[model samples]
Target: MINLGEKKLILASQSPRRKELLKGLGFDFEVRSKDTSEDFPINLDPSEVAGFLSAKKAAAFAHEIVPNEIVLTSDTVVILEGKILGKPANEEEAFEMLFALSGKTHLVTTGITFLTLEKELTLSDTAKVFFKELSGQEIEYYISNFKPFDKAGGYGIQEWIGFVGVEKIEGSYFTVMGLPIHLVYDVLKNL
Candidate 1:
């Protein structure tokens, strides 16, 4: 168990996966989604891009933070071949990303920002996921059934495709899911 010193928790995201992950840690929090453009310069690395976006989202609420409220924001991205693959625009793009990731290892990065009236902390977690070779049919089937337009990398590690395709993972599974619960717990404990 941990104690947060009178800080009201606020999660600034609309992702159900992130909400669910945070709930699993047994913290009481409120959800407040913000509208922020997620654009970044093309030259930023994958992890840096995620961190920047996460902080950007937090900064969007800088003037709204109450004295006793802490806001949390996060961004996750998929990186392959040194290129960042954000959420797919359509099924065709989803298929392309999944196909490109088939039988390969890729990095999943989740950047988290904790903001309060007097302090801010931004951290990122990276996971290496290895997938077995996926057939074209399997890729199409997964996309058709899962419709992962909101998920980075066009797949969910907690879903059917992960059960069938993911061969190994080298870091926090929850990071691939969108939030790093362990890191969040630790950070909150110290906040």
Candidate 2:
């Protein structure tokens, strides 16, 4: 178990998966979702893109942090064919993203920001995920049934599609779930 010492932990996001993953670390924390527009410049690398977004989210909660509080923010994205696939806007887009990812390996990068009154730190973790060739029917069925509008790359590793389609994964599985628990725990411990 990771102890955060006397720092009051606060998570600044609305992702239930992140919340659950953080809770699995056995640390006490609070969830406060902040509304921040996610817009990044085109020239940034994939990891930089995620880190920038995470820092943006953390900065959005600047007014909420106190002296004894540490706020966490994170962003995850799937990069395939050198393009970043964020959350799909609808079912058709979701199917399209899945189709593009079929029979290919993609990179899943999650950036995390830890902010406190004393210091602010931002870091990123990347995972490689391989998918077997997915049929159009399979993509359609998964998108129609699961409605993965909230997941990057239009899929979740813990979802039905992952069980049926994902072939292999390299690096931390929790990063693909939208939070890198191992990295987060390490950062918090040092803090």
Candidate 3:
């Protein structure tokens, strides 16, 4: 187990998956977040968006960080064919996004940022997820029951859709779920 040694940990995100993953670390951390815009430059490569956004989220707490506090922020992005698949706005959009991902492999990239009063460290983890060919009924059922409008790529890998659709994953499973907990644990050990 990693010890904080009097340093308080803060997670600056409201993602339920991230909160759950952090909790699994057995650390007592506070969940706090700012309403930072997730917008990114259109010219950026799909692979860089998560890191950029995670850092951007971390920047929201820059002036408030104290010497004994370590603030962590993260963002996850789903990429298919070199483009980012963002959270859908509605059911139709969600269905369309999931349809596009059917039977294909995609990348899930999670960027994490650790900031103290002295220094900031930002890193990212990427995972390749292979999906089984999904039928229309499967997509509709998942969408209707899961209501994945708030999730990137219109799905969460830990959900029912993942159990039925994900054939294999080439990287950390937690990355697809939204937070790379193993990587987080590794970094936390050194903090």
RMSD of each: 0.8, 1.0, 0.8
Residues 1-191, model 1: lDDT tens digits: 77776889999999999999988888889999889998998888777988899999999999989898989999999999889988899999999999999999999999999999899999999999999999999999999999999998899999989999999999999999999999999998887
Best first by lDDT, ranked: 3, 1, 2
- Rate residue 187 of model 1 by lDDT: 90
Which regions of candidate 2 fall more than 4 Å away from where they truly are?
none
TM per prediction: 0.98, 0.97, 0.98
Tens-digit lDDT string for candidate 2 (1-191): 66667789999989989989999899999998878988899899776888999999999978768998999999998999789999999988998999999999999999999999888999999999999999999999998888899998899999889999989999998999999999999998787
Which residue window of length 10 is worst by lDDT in model 2? 1-10
Give the clash count for each candidate: 0, 0, 0
Q: Judged by TM-score relative to the true structure, which candidate is superior, 1 or 2?
A: 1
Error of 3 at 57 (Å): 0.2
For model 1, the superposed segments whose C-alpha errors exceed 4 Å read none
> In order, what lDDT does every prediction score?
0.92, 0.91, 0.93
| Colliding pairs, model 3 | none
Give per-residue CA lDDT, model 3, range 78-170, as digits (tens). Answer: 999999999999989998999999999999999999999989998999999999999989999999998998889999998999999999999
